[model samples]
Target: MNNVMGIALSGMRVAQQGVQVAAHNVANLATPDAQRLQLKRSAVEQGGVQASVTPAGVDAAAQLGDLLAAKAEVVAFAANATVIRRQDQMLGSLLDREA
Candidate 1:
């Protein structure tokens, strides 16, 4: 359904933002007084998900944990995308058969 696609797309965007935040943290590792950033997730009132970036402070261990979590998020995003693709393909096949 369209809602499913919207949710999956939002999830992908969150995962992408998380990956970007992790990369930024790694890039600024050597910079003095650098603040680590993280993506915060929330459900949309209309029935989807959304994310916002926030400062997480400067803790290396926490940042590492966040990076690992972000990797898992990326995996989840990939799985969702695959499901969406398969669903689209199945719908197309059904339409073709009907035609």
Candidate 2:
């Protein structure tokens, strides 16, 4: 196909973007409030972001969206966890005191 080089080059660019996005995610992984992000790509026909055969999952843009969703979940869990943990600890203390 005449578009092979174009495809190859496009794939490289997407891969580069993926690497950068992954690095960004790694940078924030340690942060409790931080989230990971990446874009999604596909070798789709008609204006598709050409990608290699690796299923082209989790590109930078998609990653951002995922990050937000994950953060929301984390926030929810953190809220519940904190309250539950504190309640459990307080209950334990009360029981110990009574005993």
- The residue-by-residue lDDT of candidate 1 on 1-99, one tens digit each, is 777777778878887877888788878878888888888889998666888999886564975776687688789789879968987998899999999
- Which residue segments of model 1 deviate by more than 4 Å? none
User: How many residue pairs collide in each prediction?
Assistant: 0, 7
Instruction: Give TM per candidate.
Output: 0.85, 0.42
The Cα RMSD in angstroms, rounded to one decimal, for candidate 1 relative to the true structure is 1.7
Relative to the true structure, how large is the alpha-carbon lDDT of every model? 0.80, 0.53
Worst 10 residues of 1 by lDDT: 57-66
Tell me the lDDT of model 1 at 7: 79
Clashes of 2: 7
Q: Worst ten-residue run, lDDT, model 2?
A: 47-56
lDDT of predicted model 1:
0.80
